[model samples]
Target: MATLIVEVDDNKLKMVKDVLKAMGVSVDKKSIKPEKAPNETTALAIKDARNGKVTKVESIDVLFKSI
Candidate 1:
């Protein structure tokens, strides 16, 4: 069993998750919040796509064994 950590555009997070799920992989979505609020902070989300068909991802950060 292996874990993959991916940093993707906030808008594409949902699309990524759906792709992973279709491949029978379990995914977890995490939101990155700034420690302090700023005038305008860009929001980012993290998605953990694990198991099955991970080799199909080509454009996202792929971390093996990263929880």
Candidate 2:
């Protein structure tokens, strides 16, 4: 098992989660909560992605299993 922290647009969270689930990955929403808590950071980020606010995303963290 491992943890993947993706800094994706707010609206894309659902899609990302679904994709991860489909890929057989265990995702923990509460663990990888966004940085701008309680705000529309994720939503705004998604909007920005749609409106070309940013060419690419800021950053993402992924924890891999040591094996």
On TM-score, the candidate that comes out on top is: 1
Model 1, residue 33: distance off in Å is: 2.7
Looking at candidate 2, the ten consecutive residues that score lowest on lDDT are 58-67
**Quality of model 1 by C-alpha lDDT:** 0.54
Best by lDDT: 1
Error of 1 at 56 (Å): 14
TM-score of every candidate: 0.50, 0.41
RMSD to the hidden true structure, all candidates: 9.9, 11.5
lDDT of candidate 2 at residue 26, scale 0 to 100: 87
lDDT of 2 by residue, 1-67 (tens): 3223356567677876786688787865533346646346555655666775554424432212221
lDDT per residue (tens digit) for residues 4-51 in model 1 = 546678887888788778878898765455785423212221222333
* Clashing pairs for predicted structure model 2, backbone only: 10-42
Prediction 2 TM-score vs. true: 0.41
